[model samples]
Target: MTDEKNMNHNNEEIIEKAKKFFREIIAENHVKNTEKLENIKEFKVNPFTHKYLANFLTGNDDPKSLAKALIYPRVLGTSITTSFGQNLQTFVNTTLEGYGSTTTGMDIEFIDKLDGRKKYCQIKAGPQTINKDDVTTIRNHFRDVINLGRTNGIPIANMDCVVGVFYGTYNDLSAFYKNLAEDYTVLAGKDFWYHLTGDEDFYNKLTDAIGEIANEFDGTELLEKTINQLAMQLQQVDGIDE
Candidate 1:
């Protein structure tokens, strides 16, 4: 009975640590995103533009969205920099890291131990992005890793590469990758999520959590402020100076 209690206590402690670390990661990214929004140059109401004000007055969903829509540069810049696909990868990486796994670098290398053997994973957004160049790079990287292992007398079979993708299938990949895909353990979509969490619904829960975090930074308040400022510019157009 005492041993079972101790095991439960350990599990609880691990759960708490995971929650704290995950929250901190989200909070840190939120701060950075807020800073980016704040640093964008103040929105100026162009006198010649008539649609912007109208959109602000009666836009789809709410005035807040219209106000946000008017900041064309900010919208485009954030989309380009923090793309949805990239954000999804960030969610996956941070979640894994919170669970005490080591996530590293561009391709999101997740190093883990499986059946007393080391497994090296590379996660990609989709197979569509996997071109000949990517295959060559992966091949060379594994070659170097194998050579290093052999030099140290550690047997490494192709570096035990595993590729996990958020989307896309073998059909989506080009011909070269299709053939090479057989050499690696390729996990797609739910299979990838299942491999990570042992639950196929894990990705659904992750996406829901991501959506909630996204709502917090939708820039609603900032949009309202911009609309108010633009209203002041509208007054100027009406020959009223404030």
Candidate 2:
């Protein structure tokens, strides 16, 4: 009974540590994103005009989508999803250093708290970004990291590799991840978070934090203004009515 209690206590501490690391990344990125938000208007829109104009010339007659195209580079501070995955991995590296785990300076290398084995993960914001060709590269990376660790004194048996999908469940994962599944372990959504800190809800908990950040940062004023600007630009363009 005493042994079980100690294990539970340790698990709680690990979960708390992971949460603290997530908060640090959120706070740090909030500042950086805010700064980018200030200069939102300056982001280039020239490319979008040409790209969408071509679409207009083709079959896409909807001028309304132009605003969305503009928003990608301007608002949301240039792909928040992409930034979140990178930042999450980064903060985890920091936590690994302070915690019992060691930072391997690779993609996302850390020791799993639940198991004594070390994990080297290729963290992705979502499964959609992975392509068929990326599978081979991912596998090769794992092999290389294992060899590197062996050289550094960590045995091959003591280490494992994984493709950590930041969001979505296994069933929801894209077909591209099919190839990866045949090789190394692929943990997604709740399971992936559990693998990291032994906390199943870690994914949801931190993602809820991200939602709160979105609520705080997803201002309607700028969005409406940008859309209005794009609408006028579209009006200037010769609209093709189908």
Candidate 3:
């Protein structure tokens, strides 16, 4: 138990690098995105949608204030997560033992050298992250890749494609997951991490590392300041209350 515990703690080389990268990425997102909020030229209001939701949702609170609250953080959160997701792919490619970036979202470009067969992967953050349209788009992407490979003398039978979800259980996933699984490999959480690193416990270890690193960053001031900044901007918007 002690040696096992030590191994987990000592797995910090990658974890530590992940920690540094994660912090830098998050902090950079905060500084860069928050400034963009300050330079906002306008806030477009969908009068009908914004009006009804604000009245019913906030129990008659000022809709304009509500709009500011919604717009800033929602946009910021989406921007951060989307960019963070991109960085995550780079992180995995660089930090993991046998992964690297790909031209067409391939799982292991290196796999072809080993078995003379190519493997491609389209990765998502979670099972619920994809929708019906996304599935169709992914299917199209796969088709295009396979066609391109065929032109290069690679047969279809030698190509494998995967939809890899970083976290979730397959049995508990959505119809979208099932749809993808109908035609390609779908791995989630433990299965996904295991597929990449061949260690079933990697997901747990990864979460543990993330949890520890997360505790080091305190965002109290940032959050409060952002809300204030956004709230102030509402005053400048023309006809926001209407």
Number of the top lDDT candidate? 3
Indicate the residue-level lDDT of 227 in model 3: 54
Per-residue lDDT for 1-242 in model 1, tens only?
A: 99547644543443443344445564455444443443223444453543555465466424334344555444446433355445555555444443332423224443332323455566666666577787777766656666766888977674265667765555665565565666766666656655554445655655455445554456566545655564444434433111
* Regions of candidate 2 where Cα sits further than 4 Å from its true position: 1-105, 149-153, 239-242
| Residue 175 lDDT, candidate 3, scale 0-100 | 99
Question: Can you write out model 3's per-residue Cα lDDT over 91-114, one digit (the tens) per residue?
Answer: 666554344535564544423322
Candidate 3: TM-score?
Answer: 0.64
Question: What is candidate 2's local distance difference test score?
Answer: 0.62
Report the number of backbone clashes for model 3: 1
Clashes of each: 0, 0, 1
* Residue clash pairs of candidate 2: none
Question: What TM-score number comes out for model 1?
Answer: 0.52
The lDDT of each candidate is 0.52, 0.62, 0.63
Best by TM-score: 3
List TM-score per model, in order. Answer: 0.52, 0.61, 0.64
What is the alpha-carbon lDDT of model 1 when measured against the actual structure?
0.52
